[model samples]
Target: MKIAVIGTGNVGGALARKWARAGHRVTLGVRNTTEFKGKELLDEKNISVAEIEEAVKKSDVILIAAVPQATADIVKLMGNVSGKVIIDAMNSVRTKPDGFNNSFEALKALATSAEIVKCFNSVGFNVMADTNFNETIADMYTAGTSERAKEVAKQLSIDAGFENCYNFGGDDKVALLEQFALSWINLAMMQGQGREMIFKLIKR
Candidate 1:
């Protein structure tokens, strides 16, 4: 799978590395190719850097880990994303994109032609980096109306070392998924529970 990572921050960097190691072609899309948050990622095999539009054009999937406030601008830079799968890994915790409730909503409105899903936003970068916990791996969650996008996200989650990628629900559950992410943030940061912990589901 060819993936375009639109943020280059901790979350984007970690996933890019994981996907690259998993034999996926990863591209870091940035405003400035000369300098970006995760420039070191270019040194990894199967990972390269390109301008926003170029990266988007070359990849089948785009992972957005950028700041929530820049959602609109990022969408504009992505050009036409028709038939493309977009995985929004951003949360509106501190701030949301102007005129939108969250990144997922903003992307849905701006990139109307793309299949959007919310995933990778419910866990910390460390958890995404290495989902392994003793003998088991962490579980991933996603929510969106596009079954195709959800399937892509689930496979990407598995590629990133997660044990399973559970479907939360349809588009209506997108906000709930973000709230679930907030719960994790509250526990890990506000409650001082640490970021090493992750959420998983068990059944009989």
Candidate 2:
């Protein structure tokens, strides 16, 4: 899949590297192509850099791992996103978009032409880099109204080395998913459990 990653920070950088290493063509979409957060990603095979609009113009999947407050600006630079799958990898627990509850809600309103979903926001970048844990692998979760978008996210999650990407229901569940991410934050940061921990769904 041709993917445009909007942010080059930890989460974005980690996922971009994983996707590129997995053979997916990845474009690091940033304000300045010459200097960005993950410029070293250019050294990786199958990864390149481009300005935001240009990157969005050339990719099939647009992954936004940017700050929640930048969601509106980023969507404006996405050009025409009709039929494009947009995975929102942001959390608004601390800071939200200018006029929306969260980045996902903002994207759903501003980028009406795109299939948007919430994912990759629940775990630390360390886990995203390496999902392996002896006999078990980590699981991912997604929430969105678009089935197509969710499926695309699931595939990308697996490509990034996850055990599974489970559906956490539809659009109504988006906020719930964010809170779920907070559960991880509370345990990892507040409770001193450490960032290396991950979530997994077990079946009987």
Kindly give the number of clashing pairs for every candidate: 0, 0
Q: Work out the TM-score per prediction.
A: 0.99, 0.98
lDDT of 1 by residue, 1-204 (tens): 999999999999999999999999998999999988999898898999999999999999999999999999999999989999999999999999999899899998899999999999999999999899998889999999999999999999999999999999999999999999999999999999999888779999
All models: lDDT?
0.96, 0.93
Clashing pairs in 1: none
| Per-residue lDDT of candidate 2, residues 93-188 (tens digit) | 799998899999999999998999999988988889999988689999999999999999999999999999999999999999999999999999
Model 1 poorest ten-residue lDDT run: 195-204
lDDT of 2: 0.93
Candidate 2 wrong stretches, greater than 4 Å: none
lDDT of 2 at 59: 97
- Candidate 1 stretches with Cα past 4 Å from truth are none
